[model samples]
Target: MIQSCLTIRGHLSKSLTTAKLINIRHAHSGIIDPLQLKPLQQEGGLLDKLISAIRRRSAPAVWKAYTDLKDSGKIKEVPIQYHSMTLQSFRLNENGYYSSDKLKFYKKCISDILVATKKAQYKLDVRDYNVLLRLYGQSRDWKAASDCWNEIKVKKNEESYNLYMQAAVQCKKYDEVFKIFNKMNNDGIQPDVTTYNTLIEANGRMGNVTEADKLFRDYFAPKNTENKSTSIISKYFIKDANLSTYTPSAAPLSRCIPPPNAVLSPTTDTFEALIDAHGRKKNTPGLNYIYKTMLPQYDIKPDLKIYNALIRWYCHSGDIEAARNTFVDMEASGIKPNVAVFNHLFRHEALKRNRPKVAEAIIDYMRKEYGIRPSTSMYATLIRIHNKHNREDEANRLHTIYKALKSKKLEEQ
Candidate 1:
């Protein structure tokens, strides 16, 4: 199943590349002289630079770029996109974690932006509100997200609902997720892949494995001739079968046929949610089935997150061999394992498995092979492990290294 899936996906990927090249050729068939183009305004150029900084996800860079543009005296008014992109820059760190200091800073930034928008008499549009919703969601500030939703109630679209649902999920307000989903249906908004992914994640995190499985099965693996009650005709569609549901605003599944341009397939995130659900329940067979059979069957390749989850599950289940094997497979598939992956394996080896040597070897391998610096906490763990094994010299050595690294980090900051 894995080979077949990879083969099919490779073919489709090549076809896409070919089509892109053809489109590029067609686009350049009539070359326009650069002299014929209108000169970009200084304000526009500054805005582009600010946007570039925002895309880099550097808070200081974003602020400097914005300040430069604002001080240039060419700006008539602040664009809503600037505010939105600025908010997006405060997203969680790469490890999917945030600090209180960051959240407080984000709140202050939002307050300043709101004041500026009011002074400029700029009305916040749905898109701006959606960005706010996303920012609040990432910060796990559900109340703030709710406020944004209320402000955009009249203009709430699919993205608005999806972001709000994500916020509720992040805050562990699982019940609110369902309520918002029901409201979305009643409001005639069709759920897209992101919406379904959030619902699945909410269900999975809440330990509603059955519901998560039902959603995946109904939406991604429906039988050809099966009659479903809850399907809608929209610009998006699911593969193999239509999404089966009976929302108040949706037509019968049997009667709804998608347009030719409609195509919605289960994404890598969809399977990640399922794997998480099974892992939460320790349903080994179910998790393996999703990773080995279902994902390949759907032509969805496993990403780094999926592999991380797999390793975590195996470690939690005391299957060290399996966890190590998954790591090997992840590397073989050309997915660069991140710090989280190494942390999982290292923790399991040093503490749970009581293989201090193996754990230290893993850390060394990570540093040498992937150039990943071990977190201070990992050093703490190693210190404890060495102490437990009556290796005071080793413990003291690691302690010195940890202190130096911590002090260096603080100084750099």
Candidate 2:
């Protein structure tokens, strides 16, 4: 295997050496006229065919050909082609690991690809900018993505719009989502169902119910008459909330927002997800309305999954008592407490507050009523909470149980 790897490396080295010998004409600037350069046209002789191929937009075939010729030491003597097409390809390829740190790499890629396309003397096309926009979004460098967005807004691209949709999720540039939405109109880029779904999902997660509702109504529902507005007004039912309640970032709401239109009955799964999102948003009235209206009017049966969702929302919204009540309702409805439901209860009542007695009570309930043994998770949760609160005595107790369980697990293995 080592010998084969060495052989492969040697061949690549030789390929690079040959490529360096090629006399590639520096690609032109801005955009090149692939049409005017008849030699670069496909109908032309061998050289022209090569040029046309390389100039094709996002032409992996052309890129490969150029690479091959360059490796063979031919480009030094022949000219390359550039057009809007090449730029599009460059942009499309920039879609990985673009966290906040590597914004510069995305920019460099755009510039270098643009330069290559120009040297090939091809016309710049809208696709190139679209590709760049997507790359910027993948990078999660909102600032850079915003720049690409402004430049490409004149001619909208699906890739760019998609990036904005994603960037809006983790970054503070939600306006970019709307910007692309508006760009759709000016650039004649129609918003497909996917686009509307993304917008609705994003807005709902951001607690921008107004915007989410508007998008849903305009595109998803167009006829539902409901109170719709995009304000953090967490106070519809109980105005004058302690505004300073729980760290006031949209992070929780964002986390809670369901993926728009989960592939379920349009009225059931989808509405339930949105209602759960509102619960995460901590909009009491919104939660109630969804339970009262969305389920009843829509004829969606309230099932175990719905109950679990409500339990989760109540906990996430900091309504501990309500969460507990919902848990009871779920059991009364004959829904066995799944691990997830129990985990949420433990997290809220015990882990969140280091309430050991509460944790013990939950453990007793699981054993006595549910006939569920305290699994590794139960032991781990207790250990972690006790450790965090510096309750060393309690930690020792849980640690003993955890160790015994670990021993049993290993024995079974």
Candidate 3:
């Protein structure tokens, strides 16, 4: 059934491409000029074609459509929005990684748009700045993200602060994370779930478990009567355990009651951050409470990331039994274990625990049961383990396999 649907979609796409080519040929032949074409906003018109091309990530098609619209002299109708869409289209690569060349192109396009809009007296909206900020965040250019934030001429929304904070967190600017949050509050902008998640992660990385815990308790976790007296914003900003000197205006406090649409419940990412924080601190009781109690009470099912965190923590703490039990629970929950999960167990048994046989059994189980292959780093560690144990023959064997896999990967590339 899926194949049939795919076949039909292929035919439709081919038909659409043919139609576009025919239209272009007619335009080039002077059979139909730009003015003779249908209105730009009509169905299947130049604007729709350009938008479709952008959505498809076909740079060539987008350029062609854009050139046609430009020749039609209709691009001035809504130039900034069209430029914003074009900029957004170049934000990511096919593999979902940021490309430097794409980012450079995006910057150039943005520069050109800014110049054109300035001469036309067109003001750039918050969406354009938000897109630029998001691209900078993905590229890990926090400095550029800050510059973009400063360049926002219009009012900043929740997303603007969220993206800026995300970039800050990615660059390990933990102090800036809170500063942005405080600035966001001072601006009378309320944070959403993503904001709280980024704050939690930043605090977690900074080893400020208390701050992260407070954020979760105040904003994300389910609220009770005792915690309901103080509003969410006041609890974090005015009465925080840290940041004593941040005294913002009283205007924001009056608007602290979250709207009905506000997301106040914890998400999986919130739990993940809390789990990782406790794990890094070796706070077993904290991990126990989150994994065994809070998650169940909240009815939030553990995903692969959650299980991986548990396995990593157990492995780090030298509790192979607990790690194995977590792995078993993961499988029982019908969650497929990835190579990272096996890597944790393998590294623990082979290197730290000095049980190469147990590690070998794990690799065997991974391959036979799940058809999972060990990553190159895993092979390197296994090789080291075998060599340390004086198993020279096994070490050489694994070395040869690793080399072959590496060569194969390079050849494919």
Ranking of all predicted structures according to lDDT, beginning with the best and ending with the worst: 1, 3, 2
Provide backbone clash counts, one per model: 3, 30, 0
Tens-place lDDT digits, model 2, residues 122-193: 333344555655666565567766666665534445644655666664464554555556555556665555
Give each model's whole-structure lDDT: 0.67, 0.55, 0.67
**Taking the tens digit of each residue's C-alpha lDDT, what string does model 1 give over 176-199?**
887787788778888888877887
Q: Model 3 — which ten-residue stretch has the worst lDDT?
A: 1-10
Residues 218-326 of candidate 3: C-alpha lDDT, one tens digit per residue: 6665555326554322222222245232224212322542433433878788788888766766666677678888899778999988999988987887777878888
Error of 3 at 163 (Å): 1.8
Write down the lDDT that model 2 would get. Answer: 0.55
lDDT score for candidate 1 against the true structure? 0.67
Q: In model 2, where is the ten-residue run with the lowest total lDDT?
A: 1-10
- Badly placed stretches (over 4 Å) of model 1 are 1-59, 65-104, 224-264, 387-391
lDDT of candidate 1 at residue 223, scale 0 to 100: 55
Error of 1 at 185 (Å): 0.5
